[model samples]
Target: MEGLELTAFQIISAVGTARSCYIEAIQEAKKGNYEAAEQLIKDGDEAFVEGHDAHSGLLQKEAAGEGEHIGLLILHAEDQLMSAEGFKTIALEFIDVYKRFDAEKKEA
Candidate 1:
């Protein structure tokens, strides 16, 4: 609708896409598709940067004494952002483990 609301939606949408990409990346890694998994991680990083930039804009506004009322939507967007970050961490770890497994399998 308006400023804060629109920005919150943007954060949510971008991070949601990022979260999905991270999950899909894990799936690809599990299937031994390291290149695809890496590509998805790259895609997720791109989306995450978009959301992070949007969130930074809000922080900058607040720093400039242009703070607005923090609504539930904004709170939810922050939560989504945190969740996506956590998922990315997990995805990277999983990919590493899967890569190790694949390498060991090939050796065996």
Candidate 2:
């Protein structure tokens, strides 16, 4: 595969992994494993950032007039990027709600 294709694949892989981490974070919270959930969220953010950086590199290349041709793979990578971002947001909210529930239980 070409360099661009390889880069796109890497971005998709990283972001998809991040997405999974974020989802697992929510699941862990449901199981009352707050610490594990928090750690997963942190891991997810790290993976997402790496993917974002790779994606940004393509954007910079395009801006510099060394445009990378568009393909379905690249579009898919963007989809994964957006999905990861959305998952991260939802995961954070879920964690907060879980924390509140835990607090309530403690008060009881």
Candidate 3:
């Protein structure tokens, strides 16, 4: 496969894993496992950075007028990246709400 193909694969793998991590974080928070939830969020961020970097590289390539011809797989990768980004935002908000609930429970 070509370098662009490899990069797209890497982005897909990393962002998919990040999405899973973000979901796991929300699940953990729902269970009141705030520590684990926070850890998962952190882990997700790390994975997201890796994926984001790969995506940015492609953008940079395009900016430099070196973009590979577009492909369906690359489009799929971009879709996954957007999904991951949205998931991360939702995960953070969910975690925050869970934390507040946990705090209220502790006080009650």
Candidate 4:
């Protein structure tokens, strides 16, 4: 973990954690814990930013004609980043649905 390997792993770990947080947030919302769910979403956003920043470095290098050495690890890292992004959207939607359910229950 000294160069591309290091950056790639960092991206993978950060985004992976973000993805978990997003999923957990949805679970929390389902449990009617809106506060905790919101906090998890915030945490996930922070982790996502870190991963995106790391990936940006690689993009910058490529833009400068010094693209990443191109390896399976890096590709996997990119995949994780995309997955995390998708999870964020899904989590938000799930949370909203949960909130609506809670509201309806209260009204009932």
Candidate 5:
């Protein structure tokens, strides 16, 4: 794998890691480990940025008229990237909900 193929794999790997981190973050929040959950969110964001950067490179190439044929691999990578982004949003909301629940419990 070279060039576009290699870049697609990079995006897949980075976003895959981000997706896992976001899921794990939600689990941590469920267990009342807010700090760990927050750290995982940070980690996820870092991984997501790496993937986004790789994807952006492809976009820039296309804009510059250097576009290659988009293949199933690239499509899969984009799918994973979108999934990871969605997970990050869900994780943040879950963390907030968990924190609010914890606070309410404390008050009660």
Candidate 6:
């Protein structure tokens, strides 16, 4: 827990949490619990923002010529961030589809 490794770990933890939440949200939506799904989505977004902020700090430092050492851990953190972002998109889409199915059921 020092220097760039610390930051990378922070990013990885946050985004990994986000990805878990996003997947859980989809599960909740599948169960027709839209409220829970939405809450999970919110939670995921918060975690994603935290990770994004940590990543941004690194970018800022690099731009200021105080670049940190690049390593596989940092790359893994970036990969997790992107994966979480993609999961968020997928979760939202799944939620919408679930809602539509619920609506149709109610109308029938």
Task: Report the C-alpha lDDT of model 1 over 1-108, residue by residue, as the tens digit.
Answer: 989999999999999999999999999999999999999999999999999999999999999999899999999999999999999999999999999998999999
lDDT of 5: 0.98
**What lDDT would candidate 6 get against the real structure?**
0.97
Taking the tens digit of each residue's C-alpha lDDT, what string does model 4 give over 1-108? 598999999999999999999999999999999999999999999999999999999999989998858999999999999999999999999999999988999999
Better of 3 and 6 by TM-score: 6
What lDDT does candidate 6 reach at residue 100?
Answer: 97
Q: Candidate 4: where is the Cα deviation over 4 Å? A: none
Model 5 TM-score, all chains together: 0.98
| Candidate 1 residue spans exceeding 4 A from truth | none
TM-score of each: 0.98, 0.95, 0.94, 0.97, 0.98, 0.97
- Rate residue 75 of model 4 by lDDT: 95
For residues 29-70, could you state the per-residue lDDT of candidate 3 as single tens digits? Answer: 999998999999899999989999999999999999999998
- lDDT by residue (1-108, candidate 6, tens digit) is 689999999999999999999999999999999999999999999999999999999999999999978999999999999999999999999999999999999999
Model 1 C-alpha RMSD vs. true structure (Å) is 0.5
Worst 10-residue stretch by lDDT in candidate 3?
1-10
Give the best candidate by lDDT. 1
Candidate 2 lDDT, 15-98, residue by residue in tens: 999999999999999999999999999999899999999999999999999986799989999999999999999999999999
Residue pairs whose backbone atoms clash in candidate 4: none
lDDT of 5 by residue, 5-106 (tens): 999999999999999999999999999999999999999999999999999999999999999999999999999999999999999999999999999999
lDDT (C-alpha) at residue 19 in model 5: 94
Judged by whole-model lDDT over C-alpha atoms, candidate 2 comes out at: 0.94
The C-alpha lDDT values of all candidates are 0.99, 0.94, 0.94, 0.96, 0.98, 0.97
